[model samples]
Target: MALAIFDLDNTLLGGDSDHLWGEFIVEQRIVDPAVYKERNDAFFNDYLAGRLDIQIYLSFCLQPLAEHSAEQLVAWHAQFMREKIEPIMLPAARELIRKHRDAGDTLMIITATNRFITAPIARAFGIDILLATECEKADGRYTGHSTDIPCFRDGKVTRLDRWMLENSQSLDDSWFYSDSINDLPLLSLVDHPVAVDPDDKLRAHAEANGWQVLSLR
Candidate 1:
């Protein structure tokens, strides 16, 4: 079966959940005022600007939980998923996800979002696979950095190539849906490059390239 990879941020959802989650995390005091807020803000800025280095972004986001136990971080992530992601999921996005599920497609949430947040949200949506930036950890504590290549645009294709090699599959018949120009590398890797509410750059390229462009809200 071919894969259907969907981006999680503005493509699937109505907006960027990363900034909102950062604000929420700070407001709830799950992170420290001195570091968490500053680092997450930096990450948010870089992410929006499409300049975020995946490794550093993952590291900084997880830095707050370095002192906390793994279980505690998991619990916090669970709470963040419920409190932050559920309410923000657009009805149209939910419907689209359901449609993908009903089609028996092997759907994967391919995003730069962290595993802690995207993992539970994907599980709740009945999506089995999530390829995201995983934070480095040791002895149940975060190292404030990525242990693997953060699943960004080009990084996504790199990571997927390895996975596909092991699984005996290819991107020749796959579908990719995303909203950002930053996702162009991964989107182009697939046979069906769908631009969903894409940024201006992606939209222009999609039009010129004759790729299918979807507008969700």
Candidate 2:
């Protein structure tokens, strides 16, 4: 079976979902503006530079989930989806996903963003399988910690390999669409690699490798 995997942030949307999620929380007054806003900006910048420390970043991002009940998060996320995520949906990205889906490919969104932030976004795109950074829970609340290696950089390949093993799938007939140099491991692993609005390094690598480069935006 053909497997089609997509990176969620800049690849599928017009912007970064994780950064937008931080902005949404700050705008909603869910986090302390005095503290979180600056940190959020720094983290986003770090991510763009491909220097994000996932553990430290997740500690900040997931803390809000831990402070609120699941019900509250669900309601707040519904609002977040309406106010932020929906507007950034790229039409071409949706069409590409649809094309793959219509071809009976096993479709998935694999993102470094946490599940709490990305699951709904994946659903909005009509994708059922999302491999994202796992948030640990305890006593029906978030622990503000990741339970497994984040689905990021080389870790994306690790998570994808485990998923393939569990589902009896293989990358031999897979296609991966991504925008970051960080995803090089999985991009190299897949039979068909597409760089969608890729970063400078990734674009250079894609060109060097003769991979298809596209712009969803």
Candidate 3:
């Protein structure tokens, strides 16, 4: 079976999950709202502009996990799923996934967002294989730091390559769908690259390369 890969934020979902998680924490009073929101928004803008420092952003984003108990975080995430995530889940995206599944493709989601935020969403979509940025944990609690190279930009390619090697998979007949220009490296590597409601940069790149462009929204 061919591999069908999806980008989690914006590509499959109607909105960005990482940025929305920051907003969710702020709204929940889990962080200093004024200061946290400003930083979160700035980071998100940098991401859109292709200038994000993943380490710095992760430092800020993961700190709350270190402070909270695992149970508390799990409860918060459940609420997050009910409120923030479910609303942005696209019906068309589900149909796309179903199509791939019906065709006997192995479906996977690769995202820059931490697994803490993305795992449940992947489950919600009935997709079992997910490659996401991992958080370091100690004594069953988050250490507020990432473990390895984040699945962002070229890092996505690195992460996927490792996964493929481990699973005896390859890019042969592989399909990848993404929204941001940051995904260009991995997107370009796949046999079939689809831009899903792409941002300006990705849109231009996809158009110039004759890549398929789709919209889930």
Best by TM-score: 3
TM-score of 2: 0.97
Q: Rank the candidates by lDDT, best first.
A: 3, 2, 1
How many clashing pairs per prediction, in order?
2, 0, 0
User: For every model shown, what is its TM-score relative to the native structure?
Assistant: 0.89, 0.97, 0.99
Q: Write the per-residue lDDT of candidate 1 for residues 44-78, one digit (tens) a residue.
A: 77766778776656656666757677888778777
Worst 10 residues of 2 by lDDT: 164-173
Candidate 3 C-alpha lDDT tens digits along 16-47: 99999999999999999999999999999999
Give, for candidate 3, the lowest lDDT window spanning 10 residues: 163-172
lDDT against true structure, model 3? 0.96
Extract clashing residue pairs from model 3: none
Candidate closest to the true structure, highest lDDT: 3
lDDT of 3 at 172: 88
CA lDDT, every model vs. true structure: 0.79, 0.92, 0.96
Order the numbered candidates by TM-score, best leading: 3, 2, 1
